[model samples]
Target: MTDLHRLSIREITEGLSQAKFSSRELTEHYLKRIATLDGRVQSFVTVTPEQALAQADAADAALKSGTAGILTGVPIAHKDIFCTSGIKTTAGSKMLENFISPYDATVVAKGKVAGLVTLGKVNMDEFAMGSTSESSYFGATKNPWALDHVPGGSSGGSAAAVAADLAPFATGTDTGGSIRQPASFCGLTGLKPTYGRVSRFGMIAYASSLDQGGPMARSAEDCAYLMNVMAGHDAKDSTSIEKEADDYVANLNATAVKGLRIGIPKQYFNVAGLDAEVKARVEESLKKLQEMGATLVEIDLNMTESYVPTYYLIAPAEASSNLSRYDGVRYGYRCENPVDLTDLYKRSRSEGFGAEVQRRILIGTYALSAGYYDAYYVKAQKVRRLIQQDFLKAFESVDVIAAPSAPTTAYKIGASLDPVEMYLGDIYTIAVNLAGLPAINAPVGFDQDNLPVGLQLIGNYWSESQLLSVVHQYQQATDWHTQRAAIAEEKA
Candidate 1:
């Protein structure tokens, strides 16, 4: 029998509605799975069993009263960066290890209002730096599919938890492929909505322009359902788009791929270091899309190669500014001995941040320094606009662009000793964040090692419904999303 914990959110909801299971039973099923598997996976930084059960009970009451919302009673986890009231909100950093938010982020607050049970905060890259979860001060998250491999990050924990059935689905943020890369590595579906599509009122910022939250799940439909609840305008966040969110799942049945122009950027395919197996799988995926009646068009995104340099400059420049608030004087970690205020700032930050984080902060500080601002930071922002223009030009001819989510599948933990090599893993994904466009990563096929591979689908701004529709149709024709890791099953 399939474990209830392994079921999708839609399946769980149906089971509850039919009285086949109760909310408490479903919540317990996941909590038990976390207990059994998370010790090895290290996917969760905190697991709120008490709060989850309490919320589950209330969900049951709401169901009895016929007042439950779409996500009511669904047990889900949040990326540690999304602050949760009273729950330890560590951005996988020792600096704020004990810091608890007095209130929830707009996303968490909205999820609570929608009646989604909180499973607790999953681990992430410290301060949301690094492509792999290895930068986490808490420790790296193991990919459930391959114990030696890493679950791609900074949303590694959220992706691994869902893939391992520790949570039905979870929330994640993408500031340069954090959500999509991990989702690809874990064989889960992840969506990064357009900039300003989701409120960032309480999400720990890495780069304000690039950061945005979205959903990760076993299927695109589930992602759509979760996105429906998490997306909306928030008065608290000035960047939040003040528009009504449509029912994203309502159009999943519209599988009309006819006349849908799918752009394949020649630059992505020509990028060096792409694995042969991954390339084959991506080509096969394109063939499948063609078979589904979508028209394939070769397109050029000339600025693609500039993505890495542009991102390294822009993200860290913003990160240095955003992370400046972690001084011990405020809410987070503090140094014990204080000779002066300067010592407090230096010691607190030095003691708090991980190696990769400090590197970026230094890079950012240098870029934003008075002497270098016009040469590096300003120039990078200009290149960012050019990259955005590249996508805009492509979208003028195509409805969506499809490519490999990562150059390859999950890499063994500590495989890339050089930070530059690690940054290259996200080469295909960072462009979307740089452009502030919505993107989705969906399972394509397994590689030679039998590990899953993902295909990235980039959509025009606010075209999430269209993107989900494309993935939903592809999923209906393929069983890739239905596959699970043998290790996760064994642990479950």
Candidate 2:
């Protein structure tokens, strides 16, 4: 059982099946790691050792009785946005800090049926509205690659936990690159399935149209395994796709890179802000894919410049609507004293929400206001349709689109005080969400700072199987996915 923390999800399952170690043993190892390392990493908002052990014991018994699922006995962390019954699902905001969910999210429930154990709730941007983990009401999650640098936000804790070996693989929600960006910064594989491909029931909303849940793991193979359990439609989710779920694991092994056409967006490579080293790594990854028999076709994303503006307007407008339920009269945080109902609602939100969340709410409210709605909100939706059309047209000529996951490697947590700069970092990622297409971020190579760089693979809608297969093939040819952060290996 030595170095058990370093094993992949597949390896963990194999060892558990062979009785090499008990589920309790595996669970304890991770809990111990969290207790030992999380002080600096600060990834988990709440660690459920007792509940996790209980699940692990159940899994061990199932294994003995030949009733275990493929990932039975495996431990996974959930981003705090996903509701876990009786657990405090913070969504990294103080407004819901004490709000205990009465039910599990569809994703969590599915994982339970698959025999996966829950380790804890991980920190995230407040209401999943920020691009950096620093906005969490619980506090920021530090990157294991470099403690001062952020892991990436919203789903940053999930990425950091996996990257730091605090958990095997964790569930993360992607809204405009929350999962993929952090996965890129942390050197992990993070997938964002097409909109409706995964159930969002019980997962707190940021932007109803843009948010999607997926897995963040050590490699695409691990993601594929998790996706099998996570991708099915749920009757509870109105947004869930009604189609049958694909066998992601089978597709990962069956699909080959040869003859696959990967689109190279000229706009992505020509960006003035793209870091040279990060660009180099992206190019190197594409070259490797080409060597594996994939064709690299130069293409244009005509709506590239419109992505950021359209996303900011649409996402915030939806966020305003989704977050309005958190009034002082509701279940969340309320003001200590209020002279009137207006005072109650105003003070409660002002005190509960973080600065960034408040900023977005204001922007969203104004965009949705009667006088400006048509000019701002309506236009953004139109631009959003164009963005989706851009992807659809590109796919007509290429099977996948290749681009840099982030403009640069993970920077210091507080290095950028400018919100515009932060928004620009997501330039290459926001379009996929607008298009409702599946995409993944795979560690390609390291930049000069020794921080990891990610190569983003954008797939057509409902093409999770093919998207994952391509990353898996690339992973099989390289060691980037297998590389571990040094901080995780340090002795207590």
Candidate 3:
């Protein structure tokens, strides 16, 4: 039989329905792929083979009983940030290294209800702080295209897993550029839905206001399937949107790109450090979209350069507040033999959290400090509103905005030693989160290093269905989404 790992969600569901192969067989195929190839990519921190097979068995029974959901029996993995009941849900931090969640994250519970088999928890940045996956207490997830290069963080593990075909698709949380950046580096289609479109309860908070969970997969259609199960109103999560769940799959292949007004922010292309080749690839994709009848219009977003600073300030401020619970007094890592309460607090946090996480916490604490709150945090919020206003005005004349997902392709694992340079990796994607809009990063082409480049499509709030429709049309016209990394090819 053809390599089952390569088949998309649609194919897998159809195959199961036709009795061509049981869900158990499909699950086993992916489990085998993970066993053989995950070592090279280091994409997973944990692999629940037993749980996966059991879930597969249940999915098969559901299929036989004719009670299957669209994603029933389709295997997928969750980023470690989301709490998985009975599974260790470390957010790639030493603090939660052994914290097994008592309840499933709303996203996890919903996916399970849809019968999507859980593979395991994928790795991520410690508290989702870093721009590259390197900050994980579990070593950085390597890019499948090149073992030495970094996979974009903080959803790097999910991106690598899907890119290597270890899982058909995986959950990813975008705080700043977490999901989209890694997807760009790993050659996957990643969507960061508008804030609160997907519930945040049980998904470990990075910057509570900015964090959003979405899908990372080979095609937009797969994301649509996952979104159908993921998006909904969750009473448990106050931030969850109360709107009715969308039929993303039915509207995915929208008629065509005709009359789609795609806005290109002049500031994005003129950014100081954007790589020439990256610019070329993004422009080429735009040209292709134009050929498909979409019109490209140049627009100005004056707040473009402020995204990095504004996001860094606001995200860290929220993170400082959210992560305070990890002190030695409660759950998570506790210091042994503490001489005093203050010592216990200091040492446990110092020892448990990674360097990057601590750095952000410090920055956040300082930003939210009594003397500086108005100067830093409050001002950042104002700038954020200005950024949102910019998008609102742009969307008045355009349907979506287009840009390169990242400034360049994946860099060498430790090449960006300077924190400033590392933060700049998110220059292109941070704005979407700051504005609380939906954006997608779709694989466009390869760089000279054979690393994939992605073209980002940013849509107005609650426009995920429209964004997926546009991406589906683009993927149908191009073969970039079909290309696989050499490691995956070799294994196949």
Q: What TM-score against the true fold does each predicted structure earn? A: 0.98, 0.99, 0.99
Name the 10 consecutive residues with the lowest summed lDDT in model 3: 483-492
Tens digit of lDDT per residue, candidate 2, span 450-485? Answer: 899999999998889988999998999999998888
lDDT of 1 by residue, 113-132 (tens): 98999988998989888777
Which parts of model 3 have CA positions greater than 4 angstroms off? none
* Residue pair clashes in candidate 2: none
Note the residue pairs that clash in candidate 3: none
* lDDT of residue 114 for candidate 3: 92
- lDDT of candidates 1 onward, in order: 0.90, 0.92, 0.92
The lDDT ranking, best first, is 2, 3, 1
Span of ten consecutive residues with least summed lDDT in model 2: 483-492
TM-score of 2: 0.99
The list of candidate 2 runs beyond 4 A from truth reads none
lDDT of 3: 0.92
The positional error of residue 492 in candidate 1, measured at the CA in angstroms, is 4.3
Q: Which regions of candidate 1 are displaced past 4 Å?
A: none
